[model samples]
Target: MTKPLPLALFGHPSMARRAWPLALIVALHIGFFLLLRDGLLNRIVPELPSTIVTAIIFPPAEPPARPVAASPAPKPPGPAVRTIIKPRPAVRRTPPVVMPPDAAPVSAAPAPSPIAELPPAAAPAPAVPPQPAARPVHRATVTSGVQYVRPPRPDYPAQSKRIGEEGRVVLRVLVNEKGEAERVEIQTSSGHARLDEAAREAVQHAQFRPHMEDGEPVTVFAIVPITFRLDQ
Candidate 1:
């Protein structure tokens, strides 16, 4: 049980002291090296290279077009719509009437006239008398019973005398109230127009005594005959 004595590792106290310095230096160097290794692992970690695949994208091809259907025919135009305009009624405007200030008023019944109603009516005029109608004059034929103031003397036509036309012509002569021959007509033809015309002309220029009825002269028809003789 005595106090223990110190053991010498380096075989000397001085050697041990010097060995402690060397150990400290080695510890410091190991610590610095471990720190550098940790820093290099954090800064430079290897990453795998990514594959560079360049994909080319082309648009898909368009589908084929379908055929178009035919269009329908256009509809026909409808009848036109007409807009009728009615005329407005006319207005009649009459002007107001104005009467004159100085016009005289008319009475319903007029006053009676005393002068027209005072006198009596005149007596009716006397009735007139009627006269009788006159009678119609009588007529007769006097072939040879009448007297002649100037007898008819016919001159034979030169052409008839040359042709030897001979015939007798009877004439109906009208004798007037003045005892003169008014009209002459051929009662019987002479077989020749020239002979008959000559006899009619001669009788027209002659005068006759008028027929008598109760001693008064009257109008009558007288027949006269003329002869054209080729020997005379």
Candidate 2:
């Protein structure tokens, strides 16, 4: 006779106003199941030092490869030292003093010539002015007298006379023992890059005349050609 609990139905005010919205929906589902079992549920994560998290995610194991020392066995060749060179005892030559025919005529005054230690005269080397002979560089494929005193007035490239672009250009000139044009080499190329660069700028501004043979001024390689004759 003592089991009448259900709060005795709140003493029945219509069964406590119908159990008060099922006791406020069972106390709001037991306070949201104890606030989701005490915030977000079942999470005991504070124990991470598994050996400092396996020493920061596993990297401590490479110390075992130091054993390579076996190289000392090569000493078996010691028996070849026989140097006995001793054959120099035959130089005793002193037997020619038979001067008894007078021996008194040895005062000719020429015995004082031993003062001849002459090795100090080396200062006359400034007279080296005789080197004028290396002037024969002859590659003149018959360059007549190698004449052109600045005759390369090439300005004809009005795009090579409006593209007529003629031919000749030979050039290989290097003619320079002071007669200038010391280098201009396109031996025969006037198929026309503006008549071969206007005959290589008229043999590099041509001033030749240095290719003589017995009259001296040498350094030749001439072979000049250069026509480009669009009728001129």
Candidate 3:
């Protein structure tokens, strides 16, 4: 019990060599204060120098533009689509038959002479001879007269005998079958057309003596009265 003083202080070799150099100087001062508290906790407060706090976040104010709703006025174009063209069927053009390049065959005009196509046998019915039953004959008169054979006497138009212009003209002559005076007619108008054209050129150069009738020289009509008198 009393032998436990460090085993009696190491059994006392001068107090065990001064207690082993004072326990190796308190264990080298507790290992140099635990390496200066792990070099002042590894001098780490300098980590506070990492506070570069540039926090300038200014971006949040854009929400005031909601007024865009006026787009609805385009609806008025609805009735124009008529494409109906159907009329193409009339092509009957057949007129091209002209084959005459001269092979010498155009001789068909000689058939018109078959004795002039023989239609002339119908001319034998022209023998009509029965027309003579109503007569009371015996008419020879120019007032029962006519006998001149060239009597032409009328020359008074020296401007109607110097304008005294007298009148009487009747005329109407016709007389032909070769007895002459063929047609002279003023049947009565002598208010003087130069004394009715000098009494129709003196009864057309007069020459009349032909009124025979059944013995044939008949063409008659003769009323003559010509007189333009300037005292002569």
Candidate 4:
């Protein structure tokens, strides 16, 4: 071994010893940085050459579309067929025959002569007849049961206050030989009890002439339509 060097710096032994270790660490770090830089550049730079960057281009577009062809017009229908109709044969007519004229002349026959006149004789006198006088005649008279007939009374409620305010009431009645109403029935309603009742009362008290048949008083069945109407 070489003679041991003096480990003193400016008379400081601790400073000299610290300086060597620090220098050795700084040298190792510098060497590692240079080696990393060289390796990274060598790998990446070779693949990335100096190439020109250009945008992609597309194919040219087709021209604008043309109009579609139209269908052909339909042909006209064929001409209509002609029909010839034959006429019927005419009827045959015969001409009338003419007769020849007569050659001889025609003559008329003569009339007979008149007779001679004679003298007149005397006539007798005519008898006169008397005319009879005309007799007096009597004519028969016809009468109707309706001439003296009266209407029947109406059967309605007595408590009803409204009188002729309602409509008319019609009643059908039959008359007997005694000139009295044999039967009475309402033919129609007056739409009010009072008016109907009043009509019935009147019909009950009504008088009538007896109906006659074959020159004698007889009971007659007749339809008497009595109307109960308001005065107004």
Best by TM-score: 1
The local distance difference test score of each candidate is 0.84, 0.72, 0.76, 0.62
Off by over 4 Å in 3: 1-148, 157-159, 164-170, 173-186, 193-206, 209-215, 222-232
Each candidate structure's TM-score, on Cα atoms with residue i matched to residue i, is 0.47, 0.20, 0.21, 0.30
Q: Point out the higher-scoring one by TM-score: 2 or 4.
A: 4
**Candidate maximizing lDDT:** 1
Q: Residue 71 of model 4: what lDDT?
A: 85
Question: What are the per-model numbers of colliding residue pairs?
Answer: 0, 0, 0, 6
Worst 10 residues of 4 by lDDT: 135-144
lDDT of prediction 4: 0.62
- Give stretches of model 2 more than 4 Å off: 1-137, 140-151, 159-161, 164-170, 174-186, 193-201, 209-216, 222-232
lDDT string for model 2 (23-103, tens) is: 678778987799678964445444455554344578899999999998999999999999999999999999987878866
Ordered by TM-score, highest first, the candidates read 1, 4, 3, 2
Candidate 4: which pairs clash?
152-203, 153-199, 153-200, 153-203, 154-199, 154-200
Clashing pairs in 2: none
Tens digits of per-residue lDDT for model 4, 101-207:
76454466666666665656656657667667663332222223465555444544435434326467666656666878766667787776667667767776777
- On lDDT, the stronger of 1 and 2 is 1
Q: Name the better of 1 and 4 by TM-score.
A: 1
Clashing pairs in 1: none
lDDT of 1 at 110: 75
